[model samples]
Target: MAENTRKGTNTTILINGQRGAAYIKVHKRRHIGYLGASRMMASSTSPVDDSTPSPSADASLGLTKPTTHLRIKHAPFKLMHPTYLEDDHTTAQGTQWHSRASRKHLYTVKLAKVHLDKPSTDAEKATTSEFKIRGELRLRTCHPHSLLKPRLAWDISFWVAVWFVCGSAAWIINGFLLFIPLLYESSSQGVQAAAWGFVGGTFFEVGAFLMFIESLNSGHEELYKKALRSILNEDGGTRKQERGKLRLFGLAPFRDIGFLGSTIQLCSASIFWISTLTGLPGVIPGFPGTSSVAITDVFYWTPQVIGGTGFTIASVLFSLECQKAWWKPNPSSLGWHVGFWNLLGSVGFTLCGAFGYGSVGNSWMNYQSILSTFWGSWAFMIGSLCQLWESIWREANT
Candidate 1:
């Protein structure tokens, strides 16, 4: 009985020890699993926390924090998995996340929104629309020919007027000084009038010549430069061509007038000096000459008397040419009003020639006086008319 009892007790004790060992094994396994789960959660959360600061702290500091910690979650499984052992990726992500987050926290802030009301007044809107319309019109109207032609013509005309006015003034002053004495002696009212008319006419002629030359030179230079820049096959400025034709065909004859005037002045100057020096009979047939058929007579007669008729003929030809230039078949060519004035000039020249022939005794004097009177009166009247027309046009346009 005692042995059996001892054996039973030993058996029970062995069974209890086995159960305790099993229980201890289970408890250790459970504790190890919990610790492993906690370690894994801590590792993941640690990297996330390191990457992003607390949102409340960021907001209070007026910062914008980056979510770089999220990048690790998006990385390829092969890199995150143990099989790949992507040590560099892990380190790089951690570093980038922390740096980006810190910088964002320091500087990033939200921008304030701005709202603007639309224009309130009808008048303001209308003004804006008008300005826009005008701007569009200006842009659309930027044509080369339309823009350049009028401006160039105006410039050329201005220079022409300046030269004409200056030359006219010079001629009048010089002629009056030279002719005052002769005017008193000539009892023939016609001769006296012829002398005064010649002086006045010469001034106008000189002005015309100077103005023509200046206009031609400036116009030619401008046209030449413009041609170089113009498209190879295009018709550029025709003002140059028209002006050139006028210069060659119409104005060329007047060049003779200039030559005649220059010669007369030279001869007159020479005679006056010679008479002062030689102490010869100063009372020539023509006060400046010894006889009516003296050196002075020849000098004065050849250009002034003879050339005057030639000048008139030239002026008529020029008027016709001007008509041709301005009144061509093309509608574009018909704008210039200068042709009418040129025609009028021709008429004045013809009338002057008739009157001069009747008044002057010398053939040369008759020719010169008439020629001078025609051109002078014509240019003055036409130029004045043109000026008036221009002023009116400008006023109307404005």
Candidate 2:
């Protein structure tokens, strides 16, 4: 079988069997609106009407039975999409856009089998004829995979990175404030650092939510298509597929790597809030959250360790979405770079958490913890910057 996916009026999938080639011509534009408060349009080109002239009317592809099983899988991709193209979801038509907001107009675009009708002539039946579609005939079929992807465009996704950059930059500022004569030499600085962290955590929460929403919006289409197909195919004309689309709050992300990553990141930020809020000098009356090293580690350091661990786990999940495979790295892709730097930042925080324990017992441990926070905060800043660049670079060239 031969396949051509080049940009033009007609794309072909060739299978030379008995006589010659079997052809399907695809071209149409499916437009959608309301992507992150913008009327940003996404256009897709699919086969509108079967334009390929049939070689002979004796044998032709027709939809006589439910043999057409619309299956969707990544054409040449090894990451993200490969996860959703499972057997249970093959007919499910589960597909999503590039999380970075590229491929604004691209969707699942699936194709089921096209059965050839029985040949009218015995001679033609013996010939093992290939295929042909009449010019006036119509076949509403999905492709093997999405062959055209538009370049990344400006969308709600760009701002998702911006918020992340803001959040990371705030953490960097707090890290800088930590470099004082002693851990809490100046209560004012300790309070200042806590304030920075709180601000940063707030920003992180916002970014994570927005990122989750972005991924959710993209994923909704898969369910939407599945629901529509259900009605047309009469699998169950009920609203079961329609009801599946309503995944509010944080319930839907578990099955989605991207959504799950964002949700975890959001939870990590919330955990940080516990430490940041309690660490303030006057946050609570008699309870000295950051006032004394003798007890500060109990309230602040423990949550720091827990939250840092959450970040590490979330980073791993995010990185997995971009890696070529679990053992291989994909540094060429912008999504990979975003995950790479975040992974580095998570590492720094993990080291900080390790050194942060029993700070009062050892001066070296105290100094190392502070040093790790300083470096880790800056690494986070770098990662956020990379994300910002990626959000813009997601421009589609298709």
Best by lDDT: 2
Off by over 4 Å in 1: 1-156, 162-202, 219-290, 294-297, 305-380, 387-398
Error of 2 at 96 (Å): 12
User: Candidates' lDDT values, in order?
Assistant: 0.28, 0.51
Which lDDT tens digits does candidate 1 get at residues 276-312? 2221234334443334444543434333434334434
Model 2 TM-score on a 0 to 1 scale: 0.60
User: Mind sharing the TM-score for model 1?
Assistant: 0.31
Count of clashes, each model: 8, 14
Ten-residue segment with the worst summed lDDT in candidate 2? 30-39
Q: 110 in model 1: Cα distance from truth in Å?
A: 53
lDDT of 2: 0.51
RMSD of 2: 13.0
User: For model 1, which pairs clash?
Assistant: 284-289, 284-290, 285-290, 285-291, 304-368, 305-364, 305-368, 349-374
Model 1 — which ten-residue stretch has the worst lDDT?
A: 133-142
